[model samples]
Target chain A: MAKVLMKGNEAIGEAAIRAGCRYFFGYPITPQSELPEYMSLHLPKAGGVFLQAESEIAAINMVYGASGSGARVMTGSSTPGIALKQEGISYIAGAQLPCVIVNMMRGGPGLGSIQPAQSDYNQSTRGGGGGDYRLLAYAPASVQEMVDYVQLAFDKADEYRNPVLVVGDGVIGQMMEPVEFRATAASDLPPKDWATTGTGGKRPPNIINSLYLDAEELERHNIHLAEKYNRIKENEQRWESVGLEGAELVIVAYGTTARIAKSAMENLNRQGKKIGLLRLITLWPFPEKGFAELDEATKDLLVVEMSMGQMVDDVRIVNEGKRGVHFVGRSGGVIPSTALVEEKILEILERSE
Target chain B: MVNERTILAGFGGQGVMLMGQLLTQAGMIEGKEVSWLPSYGPEMRGGTANCGVIVQTEPISSPVVEGNATSEIMMNTPSLDKFEKDLVPGGKLLINSSLISKKASRDDVEAYYIPSSDIANELGDTRIANMVMLGAFVELTGAVEPESIFQALESRLGLARAHLMDINKQAFARGAACVKEQRN
Candidate 1:
């Protein structure tokens, strides 16, 4: 396929169309507004539905309803908007609906700056809304991946029968890069036998609801959800590594920060600093296996994020006390330059030296 | 033959973003990896606007004009004032002489001056100034074959814009001529 230059947000919307996502419901939010805008303009042309709901809450609920009916559906927003959709997200998880949610994250605890951040790491991975559940989330570092992973997220959502998150940031959402989209078949996806499609008197009507009056039944459902999460952990973990062999330390990052970290590591290695990078593509499963077989020569790990040490917590857990996990973060939308990240890596290495 | 990190800055209406897009599009036409990132938020809505573009033979890691930039294009005086310090010494600077009074003060950098807007007006279209500046940039760096830019232009502006193509080509040549005259 011939490459065409595309902005990250537009590419995401187009990739969803290619992946058979015929419905998109979203409200406008900065950094990700272009995504819904793209959908609003293109979805109808593709014979799909695009609705700008009154609020993020209504939009995500609409997604829940559509995905419950077994149509590939999606919704997109930034951090604050994603926060608003949390209640519906939890409901979707409870109902075990297959859907895609994209959060092009911006700085926040409250209405923070409209700059890129990885602050939503905890909100996305650890079931931000409520309950004991995990949503499969992928952090894409490039515009190409922003397109490629949207398709992957849809497939993964159907495979696990759960909500899947494509977590990017303002930088990844706004930047332009050359990309080419290809057809992704949902043919390999498991049959959606649980969809709320009408039975046509062939059998009992399929019911789709999350509310359970019986706590015992809810617990049984939770067990089933937990088993699916474990299967995702086993089969769906994905990551990328650079210069791991005979390296002393590796910087762990995802999304925009991961791209910046790669540049820093490349420059550092050219300067003869024995630094490397391990970028997490799957943020929710946390790619725990990425750290399992670290080179014995590896002495430390650095978790770099555009937040106040959120994913570092997971890195610490995944490291299992094998090595000290140092953290370098720039939060509230301030991105660390490649030089700054390199300085942080150099500082960590110098302290050990 | 260094990978190019470029900063293009001007007023919001001056087509600075489009200029950056054209450059990256030309890069893609040449089968090179490229990235373009624009200034967002209030700054874009305000008079000031800028974009960072990188054209690389290999994958570009960060879209920002990291470690300063190797090339700078200033469309007006304010942009020159802002980005003058950011251009690497021994780098290239293309200035819109039609708008700026003071030149880049740095002596180490090779600066090329063009009255692109004036030239574009002479060619009967004011907007082709961006194409004029692009012509000079391409001349200095050999970033892409000259014809690839026109193909990219059609892809971005559509075939209906074909009418403007000849003037833009003239604007490009005028700007490239200015650079050649300076060398002579």
Candidate 2:
């Protein structure tokens, strides 16, 4: 297919349609409002349902109901809106329903700035609601990745029967770029025999519920979820490494921050500084495998983010104090400049020297 | 590595976003990597608006022009005041002389002043000032062909607004001529 220019949010919506997602339930929010708007316009024409629910809470529950009935469903919102859907998300996760959730993050402790941010890293990677469940989260950096990941997210969601998240900051949601929707070979997914698709009196009814009243049964269910999470950790970790061979420092970042760090790395590398980048594509799986394979010459690890320090904790956990871990971040809608990043790296390199 | 990072800034209705989009579209038409990021949210309602556009042969590392802008196109005085310092040393500055009165304070960069609104007015449409600025950028940098921009505009405007194509082309030509005259 020919490349077409599209905004990230609209591209995600189109990709979902191409992935055979037939139901969308979402509320409008800045930065990501375009996604739901795009769906409302085009999904109906594709013989799908696009619904604007009353609240974020209502929207997610609608996704829950739709997914329970064997439909590929999705819901999207910005940070605070995503917070509102957490309880419903936990329920969906516990019920083992396959759905895709998109969170185009904005700055927030509560109703903060409307600009782009990565503050929701912990909330997304670690569960936001009360649950022992885990979500398969993909943090895409570009519009093209957003398109490709949204499709992959659907397939992954269905394969695991768990909700998958395609999380990008406001920039990825708002930016426009050329994207080609490459033809994706359909995955050999397991049949939805577990869905509540009206038994027609020929088979037993399939019940979709997360509630477990029996203490031992709930423990068993928790253990089962833990095993699924372990499997995901083993097989689904995804990351990208650049210039890792004999690097003096490795910068860990994701989403838009990773892109900025890449520019900074390129600039510094041109000036004979040995800097590498490890860009995490899956936030939940945490890409621990990338950390384990870090170049032996890398003496320092700098974690960059839009939030003050969330993903850094994960990096620290994975690094195990082998290298000096550093952090540089900006919050409240301020995107870290390439100059600032370059300065930070120079400072770290000087300190190590 | 023909990387051109441009910041286009103006008031809400000045069509700065459209200018960035057209530049990016033209870049894409030429098979170059490009990205366009707009200043969105409440600021876009009635206040100042801006966008960063990157066009290059290599993959764009960042879509932001916050600190590494190679050029700036300012449609108003405040925009010039705001973004003049963001440009890298030896960068290009294009100002809309019709709306901005002050000269660019920076001496390290190449500055071009075009009364874009006046040129657009002369060309029979005040709204084409952004196109004029875009044309000047294209002529100065040759980042993308003028013909590619025309193709981009035609596809963007579609068949419904096909009649406006000639005027937009004229505005673009006037913009290019303004730059040529200044250089001469």
Candidate 3:
């Protein structure tokens, strides 16, 4: 394949378009502005709609409207902007719409800096929007994965009839790389009988709404969503582990941090350090089994991240705190140096002895 | 496996970002893994605009350039002052001698002086100074084929600037000739 070189943000836009996503409604934000810009130029040319809404709040609702009408819809934003779209995201999830939201996360607690940060892990995996619903989140590390995951995310979103989040950091959004656009048509997408596409007077019109007047009725809806969530957890927990076979320590990371962690793991391994990496591609499913299957020789686990140890909590729970689990991270757009990560692993090994 | 972590830095109008993009695209043409990351925010508006370009044979992790660069192209004195310390020992440094007055003092690196702006000026367009440096850097590092860079440049400029195409090509050739002449 004659691969094309593209920036991560631009590649994501092209991937979404290739995946049959015709509708893109987004407002501009740092590190992810290229995504909306690309869509604006291409979506209309592809016979799709691209609307730059007045704000992130307005843009996500536009996604809801388009998704309800049976368009493969998407929107993107950085950290603070994504935060603003929470209400609309909740509404989309409540209505059970299949849409993709790309959050190229930046530093945040308030209106944080425009630099990359993974502090949104708790928000993305737990709940960025208010609800009992979970977004099927894909944490891609490389620009190629950033492009590849869109088609998969859209497919998963449609299959589950729910919202999916491609949660990458600023680096994944802004970095440029060579990526092959292996065309993945959201092919085999099931019929959207549930969509609010206008009925041609042959049958009852499909209505998309989340409100239930009766508590029991709402309970039933909640149970249905729960069942699907549990099924996804059981069937769709995706992860990658390297060098866990005979290692004394394993590093748990995802997104850009996972990429750095792999480099550190390899560099240390070359120097005879026993280290491994467990990368979570699907952050929402939280791959508990990947943790359980850790090599027996693994005596300790280190959770390395770009945030101040957000993912470490999950590492502690799954590992049962039975093994020494250490956390090393930096927030506010700082990526931990690979050398520093290697040093931490060596330090952990030394301390345990 | 070959790896080149580079920083092409200069004034905002020096086309440093575009040069980074061209190199990244050239690397892709050769079927190598590559990454280009621009220095964003306030620094972009100031004279010191820079972009990190990484070309490797393996999947790139971190994307951050970290400390020292394996190869560097500095177009102005500020860029030279800022990034000279970050150039790795035994790495290649291409200085735009037209704008930069000081020569690199480090003995650990291979520093090549190219009057890229002067060469582009001779071609009747100083805008191609970035391309001029690109020509010399690629020749010295074997980063990519000269034809690949020409292909990248044409595509990058598109038809909007078709009239300037001849001069740009001339600028690239002159820069490469300058380096070859120096070696001779």
Q: For each candidate, give its TM-score against the true structure.
A: 0.97, 0.99, 0.95
lDDT of 3 by residue, B29-109 (tens): 877878898877645354578889988888776677766589899999998888888888898999999999898988898
Find the number of clashing residue pairs for candidate 2. Answer: 0
Best by DockQ: 2
Off by over 4 Å in 1: B43-46
A best-first ranking of the candidates according to their TM-score comes to 2, 1, 3
- Please give, for residues A113-224, the per-residue lDDT of candidate 1 as tens digits: 8988999989988867878888999998999988989988888888888999999999888888999997665467778999989898898988899898999999999999
- What would the TM-score be for candidate 3 when compared with the true structure? 0.95
DockQ of each: 0.77, 0.91, 0.69
Better of 1 and 3 by TM-score: 1
lDDT of 3 by residue, A1-353 (tens): 67887888999999999888999999999979999999999999999988889999999999999999888999999888999988888888889999999999988889888888899998898877877888999998888988889889989999998999998888888888778888575477789998887788978989889788899999999999999999999988999988889989999999988988888998888899889999999998999989888988899999998888998888888988678989898889877888789889999999988
The deviation in Å at residue B76 for candidate 1 is 1.9
The sequence of per-residue lDDT tens digits that candidate 1 reaches over residues B91-171 is: 999999999978889999999999988998888888788888998988888777789888888777777777778777888
Cα misplacement distance, residue B100 of candidate 3 (Å): 2.1
lDDT of 2 by residue, B1-184 (tens): 5789999999988899999999999999999999999988786355899999999999999889886789999999989988998999999999999999989898999999999999999888899999999899999998899999999999989999999999999889988999999999
Each model's chain A TM-score: 0.98, 0.99, 0.98
The CA lDDT at A349 in model 3 is 98
How do the candidates score on chain B by TM-score? 0.94, 0.97, 0.94
- Between prediction 1 and prediction 3, the one with superior lDDT is 1
Best by lDDT: 2
CA lDDT, candidate 1, residue A268: 89
Q: Each prediction's Cα RMSD?
A: 1.4, 1.0, 1.9
